[model samples]
Target chain A: MTAGGHTLQLFEQRFGALRRARRTESIMLFVILVLLFAVSAVWTDFSPTQILAGLPRIGEYFEKLFSIQPGRDTPPVAVLSWAHVLGGIKEPQSIAYWFYRLDVYAALLWQTVQMAILATVLGYSTAFALSFSAARTLTANRTVVFLTRRLLEVLRTIPQVVLAFIFVWPFGIGPLAGILAIAIHTTGALGKLFSELNENADLRPVEGIKSAGGSWLAQMRYGVVPQMLPGFLSYGLLRFEINVRSSTIIGFVGAGGVGQELKRVIGFNIYEEVSAICILILLIVIAIDLLSARLRHRLIGAL
Target chain B: MSASVTRHLPKIPLERRTLHWGIGAGAFAYFVYLLWLFDFDRIFTGLPKLWVIVRLMIDWTLFAEWDHAELIHSMAETVAMAFLGTFLATVLALPLGFMGARNIVPSPVFRFMTRRLFDGCRGLDQFIWALVFVRAVGLGPIAGILAIMVAETGILAKLFAEAIENIDTKQVDGIRSTGAGRLAELRFGVVPQILPVMISQALYSIESNSREATILGLVGAGGIGLRLSERIQINAWDQVAYVIVLILITVAAIDSLSKWLRLRLIGGPAARG
Candidate 1:
């Protein structure tokens, strides 16, 4: 009984030492994180005092957004009512009054959707063409893979907004510039995703095609394409959803979309209109998300 | 042998073949219509001006005269904003994550509300948030930080909740067998399992947020984007090129560093190898 107790004591001692070491490590990690946080807060000028001051202003901004402002020859209306929401544009408090330029915004939003679609198509095609070369598992030439990967990296690393900013200089301020910018970024992003998927693809079919004396292109066509098609389509649809968001914001750089209208309303301090446009954008985004999610679910389920 | 092989091949139904052709033709027609609508002719017209900008960027004349210090400072500010924002979001998300997780919350109604709250936060783009916050707080990195914090909180919370939901229930059951209270059970059981995942996700957010924070300055929420937009406005292609290069390097560096840290913390395949 004493011997057994002695061994138990030794085991407890070792376990206790291990626990102490782990505790110290965790404490050290916590200290380091805290230090980093403090430094970052100082560097960014982030303070509780600043936030406290800003909180009221943020609330005020929201209030201004929701409340109706006086239009030319109209009275300011403070409270929101269902009647006001469903009333005509002549009423200052009306949703119709706030979204008076719905036709224009709608056209711009359509253009945004078109830009997203065109960019997605363009990016998807290019990414599909390049992915085979970029994938390490498929491509034999290291140099080709290396160069393609680097190119994709450069394309992906540059933010779509920045790319749109540059394209605006060359392509001029329109949806075309936005399309090119978004397409290029999408190519990079989707190329990486596609190549990764390709790398993970089952390769037995590829070997079988090779044994049949298929050329590299033929092998890829018959062996890999069938397996990767669903994944590509799924990712392409996902990219379309993301591209819609990108196309919306690319307008901020004068690349064409409802974003320019948003920037205009915000710049002019048309608070009600800002909220109106935000509501529209939010609804559209949610709709696209749901639709694409359903489509993706079906695609995966079919697989 | 060739004739016999051809005879053995299964023929596609006529209706299926027609459907395929119709789809192909329809897609082609639609693509053509969109091209015309978008005025594809502009590419040919715009090529000369595009070449001019590209050449000017490549030339990099007066490269030494560029304001390197200001560029570096803005880049640092961007990184700082991302770091601070992500840290704060992670802190705020920990509890929200628990509240949202299905296994933890138990109340489907509460979980649904929490998830919808996350969706609302995430629905608006970070740029939109930055724009609003800029107006609210006045122009600075502070606005950028808040925007990032709000957006990242939603994202990190959702991710953390998913991670928590996927945890091994057996471990939680074991901890419960010790007669520990709810908080104790969570601290010992749930937190330990999901801590690594939470840290990794937060680290990834920090990396992406760094890239995002660069552009928050376009709305006057301070960062390198302000400088970039200023240069673009002034038609300074050479300086723009330099800034783009710097951004690429900084983003890449952050990405690799975050990856390394994640691997070290999480013990991935590389670590195991």
Candidate 2:
């Protein structure tokens, strides 16, 4: 009975120590909350009543989308004729016809996915080779590292969206422009990530290779590649997910993807078709995410 | 005998696979030749046109008629959309993050489900969601807000959950041994440790989303992007320049503000370092 009581007292003492350490964190959290509230109050015109009032309008829009059809006055689209083959000739005449043209959206989605994959493969492969040279343990050449790192920074600083806009002018309206833009951005990002992974590699094996009088490439191939593959894969997969999403937006500027379809549908106020395309995009993204996470988990465990 | 054998260890030929260098040189020359064939000198001649546009842009920014107060009003609406979207996403991330965290969830099934939910949200771009919501919400700022919220929340939740999972378990274990409830353990033990990193990252996301808000508005979600797009259509290069400048300034301002707030909120080098 006495020993149990002593253990309880010891537990209380440890709890006291934990509480003391946490006090500062709690205070900081409170301050963050207060600042958030203060900023919101000053910057926004957020009235609870306005949010309440807007709810019915939101429901009305959804209802109209679900019940989309041609009325008596509305012209029914008999067929989607193709005089231009390359462009929409008659524009969508009815909401129902727009929904029927899901093929266009699907084709664009495929283009976006293709661009993302091509860019990720190209960018990650290039970065994988260069990262060996950039790693401090692998090479002591400050000049080489500096130039490579600086090059990466400049590349990454220019967002893919901005690059897409620039490419549109020079390359004209096509997926090629989007692919190039995303590839450039991915190269820089993957390079930085790869170098960091290199820096964190188990140096013992690398040192063993060096002591054996191995060439630089020998050390990299035999020692570095094995350690860094998991990290490289994880980063590349993450970039692929990011690229898929960005590819959609790049399409808006005539880069050729589902984004263009989305824009046209919104402009014409084709509500039902808009919902369908959105649902399609969401599903694809969700699938990519689930697949990537599972792959990452398996890789991390193996490592 | 060993010394003599060691001396005979021939030098390994310098692994100079010159083919790679040769290929690189060839590619560079080919690129230059391609550019030359395309009349790359046109870029220099076009500099003046670019300058003219810049000058017109400056004029619009400083001297254009305020008659279109709608433009300014729309700008505010865009900002409001971003703020609301970011706020909603952050709120959603809290529980989603915990559920997705492997350490917190413990059960593989629950973790798997929540993690997939995070990915699904983040996998699609906000612009796609904007198109969808504009249909359902009927072409307004509300649509923009919803799109940004759903997309950003998914991304933020994944990041937050990862951070949570990577945290030291010792602190949590200590709390659990004290007979604390799960919520209490999280409140006192886990939140404190990761809060600073979370805040700093969240601020960066806010900055990024603000820049993105302009593009989201282009899809009729109601923001400065609509004005920018209209100007581009009407050959109003000057106004386009003006709007670009406005966006640049806003993004730059937010960038600095995030840096400052992150420093203060975290209250140490841990904010960045």
Winning candidate number (lDDT): 1
The true-versus-predicted C-alpha distance at residue B226 of model 1, in Å, is 0.9
TM-score of each: 0.93, 0.63
Q: How well is candidate 1 docked (DockQ)?
A: 0.72
Off by over 4 Å in 2: A1-54, A68-70, A73-103, A129-144, A201-223, A293-303, B1-84, B95-120, B132-146, B156-204, B207-214, B220-273
lDDT for B168 (candidate 1):
93
Q: Which segments of model 1 are wrong by more than 4 Å?
A: A66-77, A80-91, A94-97, B1-7, B268-273
In candidate 1 the C-alpha lDDT for residue B132 amounts to: 85
lDDT of each: 0.89, 0.73
Supply candidate 2's per-residue lDDT for A276. 66
Clashing pairs in 2: none
Q: Candidate 1, residue A267: CA error in Å?
A: 0.9
Per-residue lDDT tens digits of candidate 2, residues B126-147? 7777766665555667677778
- Fnat for every candidate: 0.68, 0.20
